[model samples]
Target: MTCSTLWCALASLACLLAAHNAFAALSVDATPPYIKPCRKSDPELNQCIKHSFEHLRPYLIKGIPEIKLQSIEPLRIPKMVMDNGHGAVRVRAQFSNITVIGATNYTILDVKGNVTTYKIELALSIPRIETTGSYEVNGNVLLFPVRSRGDFWAFFSNITGSGKIYGKEVIKNGVRFMKTEKLLVDFKLTKSKFKIKDHLNGHNVIGEAMNQFLNQNSNEIIEEMKPGATAAIGKHFKNFLNGAFLQIPIPVWLKD
Candidate 1:
């Protein structure tokens, strides 16, 4: 073959190789398999979603505040009985004094199991700072169910309920005078009893009775509060209640 012809053939081969390299590079860059926020159509969208949540973790954590419970005490009954087929256990309890010290006097709360099925009543009194008369608040029976623990935690750490407050009234005593308000509030608890260990740990079992009372009372107080004031109060109330709930005993020691 002539030298010129051979040189031309070699040149064509070089050009073809260069073109092939460029196409391969472009294909790799344009169609990478990795998924990203900008690449929504990528096959790994699930991973991208997870990554997005991870990035947002700090903001989510900052948004939610913690709940605190003040004091829990026993009210009407000291002990209650429960039979879950595991064996019958007597649950002793006390009602808690819940105080949300700030502008908001509300809380996020949970009632586990069948809390809504049993009858509940509430009476509230607001002492006078300067006046002789005290405000009494009452409402009709309201159904507040104890929801599944897992579900309640997944939603807002707090929950809200609404009911009516009776009008205020006055009374007189022998040329003297007094005033009061009476409101009727009602609620129910389910007959079912949960396993002690399922909802609490350590000493919480023995304290279940008290925990129950605290949970019930705090919820009632939150329900009775003004709607406009709830959001601010709810977080503090939650913190107060959470602390009070943890004080319940997991097991009680019986004296021989």
Candidate 2:
């Protein structure tokens, strides 16, 4: 072959190779990764989900602005008067500092297409639940503002729910996507307690009066607050889960 013709042929071959390399870089495999179902019975998967929740630590305790509890119905007190010229003091309450101690029952419901559904139970340990806002002095009771802070223990037992997440495999044309559809959550608050203190403004009697009122009507209080509490908690949970896993792709999250 002539030297000029051979040189031209070599140059054409080099250009063809460069074009193939560029196309390879721009193209992605149409086939998605095989995602094995992480069933509840599967101990390894369960453990993995639980451990993965550590990534959610910063977001979890970031303090919700507010979680309003339902109002307590008017009570027909038995005209019981208090000592030292005090009377019945009706109190309305709210809660804060809802911290979770541990989480369990991490179960993956299904893994299909670009959506993954799962449920996790969190054992929330609220160190200081400030349950005080408004006070109604039914009678002439010289109480110190009726503001009380107590240590509350409650269990969000097996909060069964599922989340819809957009997997990374579906990201096309450099468009990032992360969405969380409505999480159908149903939960029960079990083993709840409010350790009432009997010390307010150096007046043990006034504190005792408030504590007695709460103790006597604990059942009614729990029933009234259950619905609102559950709803607020569910909202926070969904937000945290979505925020935690949105940036991290589903496939990468599961594998990691």
RMSD in Å for all candidates: 32.7, 22.4
Residue 126 of model 1, lDDT score: 16
For 1-256, candidate 2 gives per-residue lDDT tens digits of 0001011111111111111121122122222221122333444654544333433332223421221111111101111111122123333333333333332113333322222333332222211111211222222213445554443333223233333322233342463323344433332333333343432336556556656655556555544444443344344434544443343333333332
Instruction: Give stretches of model 2 more than 4 Å off.
Output: 1-94, 98-178, 198-206, 254-256
Please give, for residues 1-256, the per-residue lDDT of candidate 1 as tens digits: 0001011111111111111121122221232122112232445533443343334333222321211111111001121111111112111111112111111222212211111121112211211111011111112223322211110000012122321222221222211111112222222212111121213334445335433643545444323322212322232223322222222111110000
Query: Residue 118 lDDT in model 1?
Result: 16
Q: Evaluated with lDDT, which candidate comes out highest? A: 2
Among residues 3 or more apart in sequence or in different chains, the pairs in candidate 2 whose N, CA or C atoms overlap within 3 Å are none
> Pairing residues by index, what is the TM-score of model 2?
0.40
For model 1, what is the C-alpha lDDT against the true structure? 0.21
